[model samples]
Target: MVASVEEVSSSLVREYLSRKGLKRTIACMDEEHPRTEASINNRSQLRETLHIEDLYRKNKVDKSPFKTLLEIIVKHHIEQFVSLEPNDTKADEITSAVVCGKQSKIRPETEEECPSQPSYRSLMCEQDGLSSHDHIASANDSDCQKSQPLIPFLENNVSFGQRKPDINTMKPEDTQRSRSNRIRRGMMAGPVPQESTKKRQSRRAEVSQPLLSKEEENKQAQERLLFTGIHKKNLERSLTGISIADCGGGKPSGRVQSENSNGKVEQNMQKTRNVKTEPNLSDLNVSELVLDDIDDDDLREFSKVSLQRTVAKCQYTGRPMDKQTATELKAVLLGSSLNYFSVEWRNQSFTFSEIPELSYGIVQRKGGPCGVLASIQAFVLKKLLFENTEISYTGLQRLRPSNATRRQCLVLAMAEILWRAGEEKQATVAIKSGKSHFTPSDHFRSEEVLEKIMCFTVDNLKDLQFILEQHIEQFDSGMLGCILLTISAVLSRSVEKVREDMDVPSTTLIGAHGYCTQELVNLLLCGRAASNVFDNDMELDSGNGNMMLLKGIKSHCDVGLLSLFEHYNICKVGAYLKTPSYPIWVVCSESHFSVLFGLQRELLTNEDKGLEFDLYYYDGLANQQEEIRLTISIGNLSQSFQEVDTDLIPPLELCIRTRWKDAFVSWNDTEPLL
Candidate 1:
C-alpha cells in the first residue's frame, strides 16, 4: 500500500457544492472560519482520517457523501479513548492535549489552574457537543473503557483493507472462520449501555416520564396524519413500532426497546460483551443472519436483501416500448419522410400494410434580380404541386435555399416562371447563371422598371397626387389599403399585355420591393410617365430609394390620407383606427411592405367604433397565400405564426404565412416585434 496520496482537489469540492446548490457555503470557506482554517492547515490529519483521496476515486458513502465524510473526520478526533483495545499512552496524550493543554491531568480541586485555547474549545464544542469539562471527565473516567463514544466502527482504527490473520493459529480453518463471524456479529451490537454503580443508583432515584394515554395517543396520531396528509389508520399503524435505525447499525440513543427477560435477549447481550475478547462461533447463527444486516440492524436481514434486490431490478429494467412509442421512435430515427408499413392490431394479431411514399414536383430556381419574386413563385409552386395536410419542414426545404449567403432564390423563382413560360433552356440557363435574361431596360411595361419611372422627388409628388386622385375612383373610398395591391395588379396586367404584343410567351414577374411599392402606387394613379428614364439608376433594387420614396409620398399625400404602423409599436394600433377618409395604411416594418385595407361595412364618424373595423392586409411577397386579415384591436392585432390558422389552406399558403410570421413578427403585443 502507498504511504501517501493526493488530497481531494478544490475543483472537485466546488463541483460537488455547485451540484448541491450550496454556493453560499463556498463563500464561508473563502472567509476566515477557524475550524475550516485549522482543517486546511492540518491537511495530514484530514488525509489520514477520512482518506479524502479515495473519496473521489471510490465514493463508498451511499447516502449523503458529504455528511459521511464529516462524520468520519469527527469520529477520528474522538477515537483515542473509544478504541476497543486502548493503548494507554495514546489515550493519555489525547486527554492531556484536550483538557490540560499538554499537562498530564486536570486536578479536580483546582479546576481553573489549567488554561485552554478558546478557538480549540469552540471548534470541539461545535464539532461535537462535548464541553471542555465533559472532555476532562470522559478522559479520566474508568467507565470510558466500557462505554465508548457513539461513532461507527468503520470510522475507527479498523480499516476495511487490513490483512487477514494467519489460518494456522490455534483453531482449524472452519473454526477460525466461525470465530471471525462471531466477532463481526458481536461488533454489530447496539450502543453501550450504562454500567457504573453510582450511575445505576442515580438512575433509580430519577423519576421516569409517564407514557401517553390511549386517547391522547390517538389524538396525537390523528394530528400527525393531518399534517402528513396520510390516512388516520395508516399513520397510526406506521407509528406503532416504526424504528428508523441508522444505516451504520448503531441504534439511536432515544429509541425505546420493549423489556425482554427472555433467554434470547440475555444471550445476545452476553454475547456482545464477551464476543470481542473470546468469540463463541457456535452460539451465533451465521446462516440465519445476513452479513448486510450489520448496516441496518432494525430490519430482518433477509428482508433487507430482498429490498436491495428489488431496487436494483427496478433500476436496470426499464419499461418496454408500446405500439405508439415504437411507431414514433421509428418515424424519428429513419427520417419522417421515409415510408413505413402501418401496423393495425385486431384482437391478438396485427396486419402490416405498406404506405406509399409521396412524390414532389421539382420547382427550379430562376435567375436575375428577382429573388423576392422567385420566393413568391417557389411558394406558389410548392402549394400547387404538392398535396399535404400541414406545412412540413421537409416540404419547405425544397423551396428555401439551405445556404443563406448569396442565395439564388430569385433564380429559382425565375426558373419556375420560365418553366411555365415554356422556355425550359432559358430557365435552366437562368438557374445556372443566377442572372436575369431581360436587363432593367429590355421589358417595356415590366414591373421591374416601375420604380425607375416613378422616381420619388419633390417635383414628382404633384404628379403622384394627380395620379392618385385620378385612380382612387371614389374619395374617402372603403378600398384604402388596396392602393398598393391595385397598383401591383394593374402593373402586372400592363406588363403581360406588352409581353403579348411583343409575342414573348413568358409571363413577366412582379415583386413588392419596399422602395418601389410607394412609387408604383403613385405612378398607377398619376397616369403614364412621359418616358421611362429616371434621375436615379434603373437598377436600384438594393439602395436607399425605398426610404426616399416613402418620404416623398408622405410629403405629397393629403392630410389623413396615409398612416404608418410599425410592427414593433403595434400597441399604438388605436391611432391608425381613427384616421379620417379611411386612410391607406402601410405597415412599414423591417424591409417588407404590407398594405392595411379598411374593411368597414358602413362609414362611421365615431373614432371608437371606427377603430373596431377589420383591416385586410395585402403582402405581394406573401408566399402562397393571397391576402391576410390584420384585425385591429385596442392594443394589438390578432396575429401570430404559431396561432395562424393554416388548416384549410394548401401547404404553400401555410408556408408563406409561416415565413411572414418568421419575419418581423411579434410574440406578445406588450413585447416588441422581431
Candidate 2:
C-alpha cells in the first residue's frame, strides 16, 4: 500500500513532535492513540458526533445526585431517538429545549438562541423521570417517527386523562383588563345579568348545542364507571364510606384510569410512591348545598362546556348520598362550621344511624398538595360558617360544581389572601383580570381585542389562580402557596399576625417549602396560626383586630386520626384541624395528605363518655379497591397497661387523644393501615 491516511497523519504528528523535541509526548501519543481522523472539523459537529453535549449541560446546572444518571440516560435516548427520525429537510431545528414532566418546563424564547449551551431549566428531576421517557419504550427506532417532545410522546401512548397542565406557563401581559375571549360566568354571585341582550344572544348562538338528557347520560356514565359484575360488587363492598360531592344532577363519581381514558376530558391521576394522587379536581367540587349562595338558575347552567363529574358518597354508610340529602346536610354543616367551633354544649349525645346523613369523600394523599387540601377543608368550613349558601331546594338541586369556576373561586380567594399575607406586589399582579371574567383559551395572550367588557366589574379570581398555578408549576413547590391563598380567604387572623408567624418570609408568591407547617395548619383550621404547638386549642393574641385569632385545637371538632408514622406527636396537630366539621381528617405522612373520616355527625358533637364510632379512609390515589376501615373509642377504654411518654403508641391511638382528652383507638383485631 502507498500510504494509508492514519499512517500519514501519524508520520506528520511524529515529525512535529520531533521538531518540538517532545519525545515523551510522541511516545504517549503512539501508545495511547492508534487512530485519529476528523470527518467533521467544527466544534458543533464534533460535539454531535460524540453525543456528550448532555454531559456538558449537566455540569452547567447540576446540583442534585441523580442528575448525572439522568443526563446520561437522556443523552443515550436522544441519540438513539434522533437517529431513527425520518429526514425532514423543511423543519427548523427545534429552537426550544424541553425536559418533559419536570419542574421547569420550556425555557423562555431568549434561551433558544444559545444552542451550544444548555441554559434553561434547573437540575431538579423527578424520581420517576426515567419511566417518563416514553420515547425509549420502543423496541426499534422505527416506532418513534411520531414526535420529538418527551411529554407529547408519553401523551401519545399512555394517556392518564385530559388534565390542566400542572406546570403553568408564565409570560408578561401589557394590560390589566382582559377583554378578548372572555365570558363572565359568575360563580359566587351566580350569573351576571346581561349588559345587552343582543350580545348574549349572538354569543349563545355561536356556541350553543343541545343539552344531554340526564337519564340517558347518567346511564352511559354508570356503564362507563362501573361494570354490572362481581368486580362492581366487590368495589361496592369495599367502599369505606361517603363524601359530599357537588349536587350535579345525581351523577355517580368515578376514578381516573392510569391507562387511556374513554371521556373527552381526561383527568390525569398520577400516583406517587406514597399513593397520593395529584389532584385534577375530583370530578366535582365541594360546593356547599346552599342554593342561596348563588342564583340557582345561573349556577345550574352558566357554561355550555360539560366536564366529567365524580360521585359523592356517605362517609358513614358507604352508600351514595342523594343530591338533595347531601345538599341539606352540607348546608347544615356549613351553617355549623361558620360558628368557628364557638358552640355551646347541650350535653347532646350523638345518635348513631345506619343512614349516613353526613356524607364524606376521601381525596387521595397527593404529596405536593396537602397544604392546599388542608386550606380547602378550612375554606369550605369558613364559607359554611359565614357565606349564606345553604341549599333551599327540596328537589335535587341540579348544578355543576364548575371546577374551572372553582379554580376561579380559589384564585380570587388567594388574591385576597396574598393581600392579607402582605404579598402586595404579587397580589397586585394576580388581581389583574382581562376585561372579561372567562378567558377559555390563550388566557394570557398579548393581543387584545376591543369588545364589550359586558360586566365592567373586575374579577381577579381567574387571573390569580393562573398566577399561583404558574408559580407552583414553575418551582414545583407543590400546594403550600395555594394553602396560604385559601387560608387568606377564610382565615380571620390579622395581616400583621400572619406576616409575623409565616414560616417563609413574604414574597409575591408564598413558598410551600414542600410541606405543611404547624403554623400553616393552625391558620387553615382555627383561622389563626399564632403558635406552632399542635396541642389544645387555646386563647392566642388576645389583644385586638383579626390578630386575636384562635390557634390550636378547638373543644369539639374531634373525629379521630390516622397518621403514617406510629410515633407522631398527637399534640403536633391542632384540635380543629385534626377533627374538621366535614367529619373528615387529612392523614398526613411524608408530607402527603390522605383523608380519614366517619359517617356520623356525632363524632364531633357526641359528648357521651364511652363514645365509639367506625372510621373509614379514602385516598384519591384510587390504588385501593375500596376505602380502608377502622374503629375509634373515647373516654371509656381501660388500658391494658399504663403507657408512659417514652413508650410509643400507634399514631391512630395518640392522635385521637389530641381531639378527645382520654380516647382509645381500636383496630378491632384488624391490622393497622395508615
Candidate 3:
C-alpha cells in the first residue's frame, strides 16, 4: 500500500532538513527497534528519509541563521542535479521516478536480508547495558509480526542519519549487498534528494492548465483577424481559431493564408464568424483595421520609402515638377480624393500643401513667395529696364507685378538696362534725351521703402567713405568745410526728429549731406568750378559765402582733427596746400607755431585742451622715458626726424617767439587780454 499523504509530507520535510544540515529532533514513538545509527539501505528508504528531512528543514527550522547555508545547498543542487545529463543513468532514474512515477528496482532478498538477529543471550553476554540496538532486537523478537512494517515506520519518521539494521550482528553478505544498495540510492538521489515526485507532479499540473475560456477564445480569434503579437498572445490566438475539419475542408473558404501571418487556423475561423455580420466591407479603411499591427519603426520606414519612391517616380517621368508644381498637384489630388471617397486626406496625406489651412476660408489662403524666385525676378527686372530696349507703358502695366517677387524682377530689369546704357557709354545721352528707350518707374520703390533705404545706407557706407578719403586731397578748404559742417548739422539733429520727418536712420541723411558737401569741396579745392562769381553759368559764390565757408571750417574743428594734425603734422600741410604753387612752407611753419602757442596759452590759462591732447602728450613723454631707460625702442625714431635741420631749429624757434609776442601785444592792448 502507498504511504499516507501526511507520512509523505513529513518524510519530504525530514529529507529537506537533512540536506540543509539541520538537526532532526522528532522522537519516533515506535522505539521498539531501538534506534540504530541511521543509515539508508534501499533507494525508496533513502529518498523517503531525504524528503522528510527536507520538509522539516523548510518548515520547522529557522531560516535567519541558515539562509546562506540554504542558498549554498540550493545552488549545489541546481548545478549538480538540475543540470544533470539526460543520459546519466542515476539521474535519469531519479528524474523518471519523480516526473513519471517509475520506481527503481529493489536489491535481491538474500544480499539485503539480515542473518540471524543478534541474540538476547549474546547482548546479556556482552553486558553493554542493553544498548538501543539490543533493545530494538529484543522488541523485534517479541513483536516480529507487528514490526514487519518497519519500512513504513522509517518512511514516516526516520531522518538524517545512517540506517542501522542490527549491523554488528548482520550476515556479511547481507551487509555488503545493503551497502551497495545504499550507495546506488545515494548516487541516484543526486544533490537535491528532497525534490519530491508529488511536488513535481503538482507543478506540472498547474503549468499545463489552459488559460483561455470559450468566450476568451472567440474574442482572441477576432483579434487575430486584426493582428498578432509575439509569443504569448500569438500562442493564445493560434489556439482560439478553428481547424480545417470544422471549416468543411474546402481550403477554409474565408481564410487568407499568408506565410508571414502568425495567426493560426483556429483563430481565423473565429474571425470569419465575427466578421460575417459586418457590412460595407469595401469602404472599410485598411489603416483602421491594421494600425495596431504596425510598429513605430515600421511606420517611419514606410513613410520614408513612400516619399523616396514618389520623388524617384517624378524624376524618372521627365515631366519632373518643381516643389511648387508638386505641391499644387498634391493639393488638387487631396481635395478630389477626399470628395470621391468621402474620406479626408488631411490626416492621411504627407505633403505640406495637402494639409488643412486655418479655418479662415480659401480666399485668405494664398502661397507666399519663394526666396530664389524673388531673386531671379529682381535680376530680370534690372536687365529689362536699363538695357535701352523699346518697352511700352502698356506692356509694363500688363506685367502683373503683384508680389515682392514680380516687383523685384522689374527692378532688376530696370537696373540692367541702366547698367548696359552706362557700359555702352550712352548713359549721358540716355539721361538727357528723356525719351531714350527703357523706362522703369515701376521698379523705383518697395512697400517697405524706409527699410530699403536704411539697408542701402548701411550697405554703401564703406564704399562712400573710401571714395571720400581717396579724393580728399583734391577738395579745397571751402569744400572740406562744407562737408564737415553738413555732417555736424545732421549729427546735431535728434534721431527722433529725423525719424519723424525722414522715415529712415539719421545716418542716411548725414551720409548724403556729407557726400554732396565733399563733392562740392573737391570741386572748390581743385579750382574746377567756373570762375565768374556773378555769371549765370558759374556755380561758385565767392564773396560772403566764402567767408561763411571759413566760419564753418573753424566751427567744425574738434579734438579728433587736432590729434590727426599732431599724428601726420607734415601731411596736414600737404592736404591743405594741394599744390607746390601755394606757399606751403610758410603756411606749415605758421601752423606749427600756432599749435605750440595754443598749447602754451591753454597751460597758462589753466584750460582743458582736451583728453586727446592730454593722452598724446602723456603717452609720448612716458614712451620717451622708457626709451631713455632701454634705448632699443628709439632705434627707428632717429630716422623719422631726419628732415628737421639742427641749424634751422634756431630760426624756427625765433619765428615761433615772434608770432607769440605779436599775438600777446595785440591781445594785451584789447580788454586786458582776457
Candidate 4:
C-alpha cells in the first residue's frame, strides 16, 4: 500500500458520498477528513469495494491487479479487528472491509470462505451471487487452451510461467482436490485469457482484457436490472446494515450463474433466509408507513450506522458534530424543528436552510411527533411570517441565557411558538404547585376550555410526567414534555370530551391511536376540538341542545392544515387554514403530515386564474431523506407529455393540492412519483 493511503481513501469515500447525493455528509467529511476513523489502503481494495476495478482500468486509470487485501482500521478502535486463525495459512486471512463510513469491520466468514480457489469462488458467489457451474462448464469450452488430466493438490508454488500449462491440463476433480493449495491462481481469473493458433498465447492474453471489460459490463447491466430503485436501497440495508452509506454491493464483482448452480443458489438463499433478521424498511406510501412498524433498535442501529460514517454539523454553528458530541442531543435537546428544503421547476430551483442538528434527534416516528413536527412548522412559518430575526439558526443560537446550546434553543423555540400561537400572547405563563387556570387563546372557543398554554413547572426532569398528570390532565400520553421538550401545551382536552362536544359516537373512541387526528390538531390550534371541517360555525346537537361550533379560524392563522380545507371544499377556508399568514401549510395525505411552503409570499395573495408559484415538500416522517423542491408552472398551455387528471395522481401531488386547489402540477423532466 502507498504511504498516502488515507489521502487516496478519503478521496474515494468523498466521491462515493457525492454519488449517493449525500451533500451534507460530503461537507462534513471535507471539514473532518485525515481525521476519518477508517479507510481502504490500496488500489485493489478500492476497486473491490467500489466494484469499479474495470471502470478504473477501462479508462486506463490504474491497471493494477488484486495482490493485497484491505486493512481499513478505525483510530483508537483497534479492538474491532478480528483476525483469522493463525494456523490456517495466509489465504485464510484475506479479509474484506465494509465501507459504510464510521466503523469498517472485516466480516469473519466460515473457514470455507477463505481466498483459496473453491472457497474464494463460493465467497464471490455469495457476494456477486455468481454460481460455480459456469466455471465448471467453461473448463472444457473453447475458451480453455488445453485439456488433460490435471494434478490434485497442486501447490501455489508453481513457477509463474509454468502455471498456465499446469492449469490447462488440470481436471475438474483435480482442481477441486487442490482448491486449498491453489491460492496464488485466485478465483475467476478466467484461465488467464487463452488464445488458439488463430492467435498466439500473447494475443490470447491481450484479447482477455477486452473480454474482461465485456464481462464486467454485462455483470453491471444485470446488477442494475436486479437492484433498481427501492430494491437497491433495501439491498444496501440488508447486505451491510448501512442505512445512509452506499454498500456499493449492488453488482458483486463476479459473473453470472448457470443451471447446475441453481441448487447451490437455493442452498445459499435458504441459509440467508434462515438468518433471523428484522423486517426491512417498507416501500409503503402511507405517511406513517415507516414509523408504525419502526422499532427503537432500528433507530439505534440507524444512528450507530449513520454516525459511524457521517459527521453531521451543528445546525446553528455549522461546526462538526462528531458522533460522541452528537449523543448529547438525545439527552438534553427538546422541541420541534423546521426542515427547510429547496426544490426545482422550469429550470428554476431554490433551496431552503437545513436543520442538520438532527443527529441523535431524528424524528421519533412511533409517537407521531406531530407536536414537535407542527410546532417546528409554526416556528419556521412564524420566522418568515414576522420581521423577527430571532427564528433564524444563528439568531436562535444567540437566544437568552447566553450559554444555551443548540438543543435548548429548539425547546425555547417550541415555547415561543406556543405563546405566539395563543390568544393572550404573554411574556410568561407558568402553572404552579397544584394550581391550574386558563386564559383563553384568541381562537379558543368560549364554549370549551377557554385556556390556551396549559403551562406547568417542573423542577426535576424525572418529575415532569407527575407534574403533567397533576395539572394538565388532558396532556397527550405519547407526546409528553420529555419528547416535545416542554411541559406546556397550546391546548389540551380528553378525546371523550372532544367527541361529546362534536356529536361523535363514543363507539369510535374505544382504542388508543398512535397517530394524530383532525380533532387533535384542531384542539392544538383552538381550545375547542371541532370534528367537522366547515367554512363557518355549524349548529350541532351536543346531546344537551343545539350548540354553535365556532366558525373555523377567523383571523389569519400562524400555521394551518390544508387537508381540512381540501376535503371540505369551503371557499371561506382559503382565508384561514388554506393560506396561513406565511406561505407554509401542513399537508395531511394518506394520514401523514408534510409541509408545503414556497419561496415567495405572493403565492398566498396571487389570485390569477392560472397562477404559477413554486412549492417544496418536506416529508413529515423523514428528517434524513432529501426533500423535493417543486417548480410549479400552471397555465392553459398543456404539453402532450402531460398526463390527464384522471390518471393516478401521485400522493405527493395530492398533498400539494391539499394546499393549492385546482393546481396543475407538471413534473417537467421528472416522472410522476406515486
Put down candidate 2 lDDT per residue, 1-674, tens digits, no spaces. Answer: 23355554454454445445454474466446533332221333333444557665665565652323334445566776566545432111332223323332443444423222222121121222222222222111232322223454334442344432221131224111111111242211113365565455334424422375655445444543443211322222223122322234433334342223433322222221222333232332324211211344434432211222221121111122123322222222122211211111111111111111111221323343454454443333223222324322221110111122223333343444444333232232211123533332332222221111111111344444444544332111222233223323322243445545533323111224434454555444444443444455344554654344334443433222334443354335544445555566656555555555555556677867877787655443334443356767667656553354524554555545555667666666655644
In Å, residue 357's CA in model 1 sits off its true spot by 46
Ranking by lDDT: 4, 2, 1, 3
Residue 437 of model 1 has an lDDT of 32
**Candidate 4: 10-residue stretch with minimal lDDT:** 340-349
Best-performing candidate as measured by lDDT: 4
Query: Which lDDT values do the candidates have, in the order given?
Result: 0.29, 0.37, 0.27, 0.40
Residue-pair clashes per prediction, in order, are 13, 35, 54, 12
List ranges where model 3 is wrong by over 4 Å.
Answer: 1-551, 554-560, 563-674
The order of the candidates by TM-score, greatest first, is 4, 2, 1, 3
Residues 220-320 of candidate 3: C-alpha lDDT, one tens digit per residue? 45564455422223222233332223335344533342333443223232222222222222222223333323445547744654444343333211122
lDDT of 3: 0.27
Which residue segments of model 2 deviate by more than 4 Å?
A: 1-366, 378-497, 502-513, 529-531, 534-590, 599-601, 605-607, 620-625, 635-650, 661-671
Regions of model 4 farther than 4 Å from truth? 1-409, 420-422, 425-487, 490-512, 526-528, 540-551, 564-574, 609-611, 622-624, 636-647, 658-662, 668-673
